[model samples]
Target: MWRCALPPLPRYPTVDELGARAAALVARHPRDARLRRVGTSRAGTPLWLLSVGHGSRQALVVAGPHANEPVGGATVLRLAERALADPRLCEGADATWNLLLCLDPDGARRNEAWLSGPYTLGNYFRHFFRPGFLEQPEWLPEGADGATLPETRALLDLQDELRPFLQCSLHGVDVGGAFLELTRELPGIAQRVARTANRLGIPRELGPYDTLYWPTLGPAVYRIPPPRRGDLAAAITEAAVESTWFHPHPYGTVTAVVEAPMWGVAAVEDPTPPADADAALRTVSHTLRDDTRLLEEILARVRPLLGCSPDVARLLAPVDDYLLVGPGLADSWDPDLRQGGTRPLPPLTVARLTALRLAGRRVALRTAGLLHQLVTASGHDPRGVLPELDRLIDEWCADYRDGCGARWIPVARQVEYQARVVLAVFDLAERDARVRSRSGETGWGSPAAVPMHRE
Candidate 1:
């Protein structure tokens, strides 16, 4: 982490509050900070990019890439404030900082109800909103629907214009612990991140998550998986063409995707291998299938009444994807084996499996809640299905609470952990640049051939 200290944030901000903070930075440092209207959201909200410093190289920091993961919004504002106040931050990194306040303002606005939070599990799901994969700005496949979201176009435009050597996208999870995905393996940085989380008493997420399939560099650190055309229909894969794959540089841009959990669960931190490994996998798989069927039945009842509401469709896409894709992709895993017939999974694998199972339950409950919201918003008497959905949501929520014993992580700590990881990545980039300079190679994309693991 850098010398500048970030005070813990009390709460996540709304999209407008994030914008206001960005504007305040420009006001405070008018000579150094330049706020640009890069593009407009689908809702016609102006998207702002706050550019600070005039270093020879450039670094892009994107917050709110996933709407519900708003911790990054506060993280971005704080980092911008620090960059403006302490010019050495950009000077040391030798890169200009371009911070995008929020990528998906439309989706972020939908989640505003929970942003200023009491920070409870129930309160979060009640107002939660995640767009369908296609509806997402950066992840949407090229020409899949013959159109691109304005927000996505803006991102592409910015990438082309800036051609940053380093990019960090801020993201977080609802529960579990913190994890990171890096495009290029930077030695010592991942260990530093783990140490930072440990120092803050935040357990590194060892469980299965969206990027479970990616290659691991160390504990809670992963190399981002390359895009595959075949993964398009997979429920767990989410998108075949992720935002990280669109770098403009020829060699490669070092991209870091930081995921901090809002709630901490002990189950995911345990590294002890499970005894009945096959049975555990089977149970997780079985529960996912059963829940998918249950949600399918619920959606069937309201399919006719909803009248093709795009918002409802987007809201239900995750559940729908699970139902359509079968017990494959996101939900399926084979046991590890040696020359011996079969081996017990590693402790981290077991923890991930447990987390994945519990995550399925959360997805089911969230889907039910969204369904109830849709029915009520449509002016229909939802009593017919809501009572059942409510009961399921309550029972599943209870199961989630009891199963994982997840504790609400304070927003302040979450921001601090994220900020530390970002700064670590920045420091790694700076160190790599110096190494390249010493080696007489001044290319933007070619990071010095640093070892993947270095203490």
Candidate 2:
């Protein structure tokens, strides 16, 4: 087995640094690996694709298309290293696989500083605020002039050229527990994937946890709704049609955008865990393998079912609501912490509530902490928590509408906002309980804590 020396974990890396690291890795393992500069970012950073493996005809294309979600980038890098060292992983596969590690170097680099340091819940919270272009790297194929971004253009070019059987776009979510999204229907794969997670002691949940779980593509192949229009899921289906020019392949390409929760992968605790790189690596390895197996199973079962005649557009639809929201809350609760300064109350409130429920803080203390966070961070009045939360939500929506300049802001914001709102609610509940206890009205036991939604 060829084991490359593991680089020490840093909080983050600059865009240039990330590019250098990627280039070096490609250079060091050139025998089975080749690096291609697919395109340049809006910021003019070169987006590179690293490919490793012998020619097997069938290809598995995985890209960490988002900037904030670096776990996919890490996972891809690890996979590349593993593929170079272990011939079996590539050998056993029936088809050739070309994995595109990161498609958004500019966005990826904007948040690189956070990746280099010791992993922390606070660090994760802080990393999300850095603003990149409005267009998601993954969705850029549709483009700026309604055309793809440079990165997306590169992927599209490769997709047109290689016409691989499977494409897995790597992404990470903050709130949901871990789950898999499939392009085509795979009857028994979700259970198997869940089982793998359970075996690895990774937290797993099924069904849409929040709005983020909703469909970005067409209909739900594995879950619900047949399919829809627009988004990556839709775009990939469109791309598949052009596959005819590239090859006379028997099966149409099965493209999946896999989203794994960052917290689950890193095993982030409510109170937070001490940094442990080995444990983090183990978690990632298990997750990648579990996901890979699930994908392989789905491909094996569905390849025969895919046909060009009656286009399986519905087969490529999203199964869950992509918006992440709580029962009674809007989705714009938290401030994008990457902008620095004290982030508003929503995320802090949620953190306190989660800490109290999961980390075993006393209700009174949790409530007090919630109040403290709100008062200190958001400059909101402690006495009017509900009104403050409501106002914050309204302000956030207005800001989002103004900033996005689009009809609809991305649904992931809902999940982000909901997490913040729920945290605040939990914190407030804890605080209320404390007040009730002091006044001697013991009516309710405690608020039932709900798990963050994931699809």
Candidate 3:
């Protein structure tokens, strides 16, 4: 096992720091490492592609696919530093590592306020900013009119240029347990990754699964469901297609998404079934509905007073989505009382999941904060619905922090777990490739060839 001795990062790097650090890594190893300007962000910030080593097999690692998930940015720099320090890392896999540093710089900058943290729920939601799902670069639908972001274009261009065999997008959650989602079930990867997380004391995310609809391979590991064009379920939720499904490689790209939590608590991984599981599930549904209703009520009041500020528009986008679709989503969680034999969730699992939903509610209310800012930015008093907005924001932040028992997961530990599993997957891919080569098999590893773990 390659032990990563990552020094504790005191705070997450700012957008400027991330760029400078990436450049510094390339400068340190001029011969083996090269940095190129791939595309320009919407805000005119440069997008960088850092290449380490010159092996034939191409692997694309994307950091900051979503703006708020900044942990991956550090992971990229560390991995690049490791590769540059020891050529054998890439040499062993016979792979050239292409790292996209800060894929969504525009949104990332909006989130920079909380990046270097007093990593708390209050600080996070106070400075939080996430564009709507459609606005997200990774999930922008193909050729949507005036919808494709420049960041998305850069990613698509790079994917086409590299024709990579493996692509890994680093993603993290605000408060929950850790989990991994792969485009397909690659052999002998999930178990190794899960076991490593266990050894590192990072509990496997057992509840409120981000990939709840996907097929599960094991605890905390899931196979992403195939994206069907115009799926009714997705349409109802206004969910966009994931970037993993859009690879242009003829050999087929195996995409892995690694999610770690920013905050930690015991209940996220508790397995004991709840005493009244059905009721617990109902509480989850009710809580989300109530939060959604609150946001809707606030938005309705401020809608008439709002202006055309781009920042306000960006912040409001997801709020609109949630309000439009949140009801259906909350309703989707309702357990079928009519169905007799359905399994019930554990009490702690329900608590943690509810807390996770509350964390999201806190994020959603950020629109109100931004709205307050926008009104004040124009030199007008933010009095009308602004006081109510401030109250809700504080109320929800407190609810999430105290109710969830949220604790900051150290930056070093997060990097360690992510780097370990990522390297493990790379090794597994190498092994799988060698096996296929021995059998005269070619393009695309078959999903049915091997199970994710030994039964």
Candidate 4:
């Protein structure tokens, strides 16, 4: 038996705690790890990057780029610890992998408070808000007027100095499960990632660029248009002009913005598995170990060809545009959000009713199913209340629309639509026999609903 020495998993740490923990781990590890102060947040928190591995000129740029997406940070930290503890993993991989983890300290910190608490639906809704492009330290809008945040500047400097072969910006979403989107030049890499997720029983999907509900600058990038800005994408494009002043790397760079939904992992665990703290720790460790192995295998296939692919830049052009433009209801030609601009919200149709409702139900079932799988994978049956909850959400949206009349539906309509459905599910889980019998033991309630405020 390879006795695992991993400690019991703690609740997700806050950004400050996570950074401190990462620093301590790096300090304790065997490898020569150096911490670099990359930049500072608007709040003045210092953003740090840990550099490990020695010899190969190639760099593996990985960052928990999104604030709420903490798993990637956890994964990177764990992977670093493992790599340091066992030299064998890095024996042939030395110098070639300079990992840049946690690029957004401010965002990460903002998310930490929620992570330390109970992982409930209400908690997530209350705390989670995507940062706008200008809000992001890495993004520079046109005519910034000398308002560059420190974190952004540091990242630019790091990019210039390191000039890594690949940049992997780790992000996560609330919907759509586990999938990888890469430059079309790296389709094989995406397929490999999808296959790995599937092998682990993680829900996987593809074609994120084409299937996004709204325009996305990149796969995971979200941009908010400026007030009175008619051409959202054009404004973004114009904003990019300011980015030229901060170009860090002389060589063209290809960035892959990856969004790994936490639901993917939440969905696959054996619901009824042993709850003994020690046993749970072991189970999670083993699961992560297996995941890492799969990732390494996929990387092995992609690493060798990065330098020689002449079309890599060309293939990445569209991806770059997508990220820079940030998805919107508008596009390059039309950016106005008011004039039913470029990317109008996905038309509210019966089709969306079906998709949104299906999604809501699946999420509910997946939550219950995950717990069940963790406890007992074989006889697992997610409670039936989720279906009813889904129906309620669909009906609520339909009713609301009918009452409000057709020509225009506010963005708040969609937010309320999702929230109402979530609330219905939580309510039923607390009362219904099927849901009560399984998840009722735990008092999971919706977070206090915040009324939409319109001026």
Q: Which predicted model would earn the best lDDT?
A: 1
lDDT, residue 216, model 2: 24
lDDT of 3 by residue, 178-206 (tens): 87877767777768877887887776676
* Model 4 worst lDDT window (10 residues): 442-451
- Clashes, model 1: 2
Give Cα-based local distance difference scores for all models: 0.73, 0.40, 0.69, 0.40
Candidate number that wins on lDDT, 1 or 3: 1
Q: TM per model?
A: 0.88, 0.50, 0.87, 0.51
Best-performing candidate as measured by TM-score: 1
Q: Write the per-residue lDDT of candidate 4 for residues 194-242, one digit (tens) a residue.
A: 3444454444332232233433332222232222333445533333233
Tens-digit per-residue lDDT, 1-455, candidate 1: 44433344589988888877778767877887899999999889988998898786778899998888999999887788678677678776567888998899999998888888877777787677877667777674654234388888888778656766678999988878888888778889778988999898887877556655667788888887665554555523534564534444333357888888898877786778778777776666677667767877888888778866677677667556545554453244434222254423344456777677766666666677777677766787543887777787777766767777878888888988998899888888767757765786543533332222212
Q: Is candidate 1 or candidate 4 better by lDDT?
A: 1
lDDT of 2 by residue, 210-309 (tens): 2222442221113222233444433332331221122212233434445555443122222233264234333333433333343334334443444433
Clashing pairs in 1: 207-352, 208-352
Candidate 2, residue 77: CA error in Å? 1.4
